[model samples]
Target chain A: MEEIKKHVLDCSNLNCPMPIVRIAKTIRTIEVNEQIEVTATDPAFKADVEAWIRKTGHLLISYAEEGRSRIAIIEKTK
Target chain B: MEDQKLKEYIDALVEEKVNEKTLAFQNQLENIQQQLSTVQVRENEKITMLVTSFELDKVIPAFIIANGAASFGMDVTLFFTLWGINALKEKSIYKGKNIKEKMITMMLPSNPKSTTISRLNMMGVGTSMMKMMMKENNIETLPDLIDLSIDMGAKLIACQMTMGMMGITTDEIRKDVDFGGVALYIEEASESNITLTF
Candidate 1:
């Protein structure tokens, strides 16, 4: 796997769609192909982010669990 | 008439009927596909709101939907008419030029954050308790939701007629709000697949 440049977004304690919403807001700022590392505390977001990425056609590079939080690296595909 | 001629005539009639039915079926299929395309386009393009109530419960859900739609790249317009117009007032209740307006704003919770719950509001205690519960649960308050919606590109439109009736001038409302009438709401709603009246 190739190394990808990423931006970090903290969505601590924010529920459900908030984490995904924040990711949607931030993804537009960076250029296409650049990834976002979204850190979310809500347990539901593990599935929610995947669902959103699938619906929006964004690339979900990876999703990792760190302590109690989940981190998803999503790449924008133009 | 000869037997061969009779048989040929019957065959032609049967072929014509089949062709007609096939054409009709194809046309119906095309119509259904067109309708589906229209619905899909409507789904992705816009979400418009006709909010007639400023009650915390109503406005909270409205804001949630508006912000959700806007975050997903849909154009969101919230039309505030009637009591819904109150949601556009500034956070701090200022002394109004008109006494009636001033008194009303003052008597109200002074801001959307302080808006009373629509049900079981025990002399504002319910509102406070609900706010506390929301805070404890990491839920976004009404003010936070409104700001997030604005940041996500949702348009807040105040109905001109309602504002006139309530004696609220454009300047009295918050700076971020736009002015509109029924026609504007209709125009926005027409383009939106999801149009809700609160």
Candidate 2:
């Protein structure tokens, strides 16, 4: 069986600097090639998570609005 | 006999000396009075108060000010609201494990949860490490800090709207807190010259 290529992080209950902060912490523990999915409810996370991806050299895979929240997926680039 | 008495009395009379004083004394008195008037009504500047909503990195500066203001004799208030309320929580007394974690949270962009983990991670081995470090460093735990804040008359209030939305009752807040509506905080902010949101 192929290794699990992606992991999902549900950070909907958190506020600003929280979703990205937790994602960053979770990312630090993950394998180099694995990707992480971040689901957040904070309206400010759309801009912040994207900004973090851009600034930290992470791959912005996809971001979509699901129901009342947003799902953002970022792949570790380095 | 009357002529002899008049001569004797006239002989006893003495000449008076002429008094000498300068108009400069009057000028000196006027100058002293003018100087005294200028010295009396001098004013010290009115104090400024700063109110802040706490975040990890966002709140450190404000916390420094809140603690330091008393030292400077300036009035400072930290108004915790929403997620900002976490800073005042009993669980938030943790510092980062390493110097890097400390500097990152204290100086750079960092979150509250990671800060707790990082601080605990650095303490020593496991659960006991934090307690050991607390003892070794002579630092109070989060609960102690909260209690101290209460004893010191630091205003710690829960946001009524946030509590209602989050389904937290007034009892969930620290018993020492003075709870009320947004109007209370607004009244505080309006009274304060400076209001900050984090």
Candidate 3:
């Protein structure tokens, strides 16, 4: 098995649009094909991230729920 | 035999003309489809807002949305008109040219920080309480949100007509604010997928 390095973004306690906005901003600082792991407490995190990925043509590698936090691993395709 | 040959030649010519016409129509359809798709892409990539209120609660959401949209890589524009123009005013007191202008300046909130909520202002007491609550909740303050929006590339456009009517000078506004008229707002709003008024 191979290990992949990922950038982590913590959006705990942030409301709507903040998590998505932060994620969008963070994705730009990394290289193409790099992955970002985002953990957010906002309930809409899953849907927001999905829509963002769809609109921006990015890749969502995986998503999960750990208690109150919704986590998403996204890859910058472009 | 000559009549039969003539009839066959006319039929062949008609078939060829019909095929040519069909091909031309298909090309036109494809061109229109391509144009439509381009417009959709542009619409999805932009957002425009008309901020017509100076109330703290209303103005805060405007900046929040602007910052959020900018984060999503959308072209965001905030068109400030009328009372909303106060949100971009400099904190310093402006000495107007005449008494009326001076009164207007004195009456309006000096800047974003001084703005009070539309309801339950209670002579600024409620506004203070709300500010305290926001601070406790870890929400970004209005001034910080405005700065964040600008840093995120959200365009802040002050309505020139409103500024003139209110006797506000370019020096009274923040340095980074852009000044424009209704035409600019329409130009931005026309291409935006989401157009909001606050």
**lDDT per residue as tens, model 2, A1-78:** 787589989987565444665676677778776888888887887887776776567788889998868998788766
Q: Model 3: per-residue lDDT, tens digit, B52-144?
A: 999988999999889878877899999999999999988645564577778888888988888899998899899999989988767888888
TM-score to true structure, per model: 0.76, 0.35, 0.82
What TM-scores does chain A show, candidate by candidate in order?
0.89, 0.89, 0.93
- Runs with alpha carbons beyond 4 Å of true place in candidate 3: A1-3, B1-44
Give the better candidate number (1 or 3) by TM-score.
Answer: 3
Q: B1-198 in candidate 1: lDDT tens per residue?
A: 699999999999999999999999999999999999987865467889989888888998998788777767789999998888878887544445478766765676546866888987899888888888988989888888888898899999999988776666676688888998989989998988789878
What's the TM for model 3? 0.82
Error of 1 at B120 (Å): 1.7
Q: What does the lDDT read for residue B61 in candidate 3? A: 91
- In candidate 3, the residue pairs with backbone N, CA or C atoms under 3 Å apart (3 or more residues apart, or in different chains) clash, namely none
- Considering just the first chain, candidate 2 attains a TM-score of 0.89
**Inter-residue clash pairs, candidate 1:** none
- Candidate 3 structure quality by residue, lDDT tens digits, A1-78: 556669999999987767887887898789887899999998888888888888889999999999998989999888
> Which residue segments of model 1 deviate by more than 4 Å?
A64-68, B1-44, B91-107
Which scores better on lDDT, 1 or 3?
Answer: 3
Candidate 1 lDDT, A1-78, residue by residue in tens: 777678999998997558877988898898889899888899898878877776788899898998988988899997
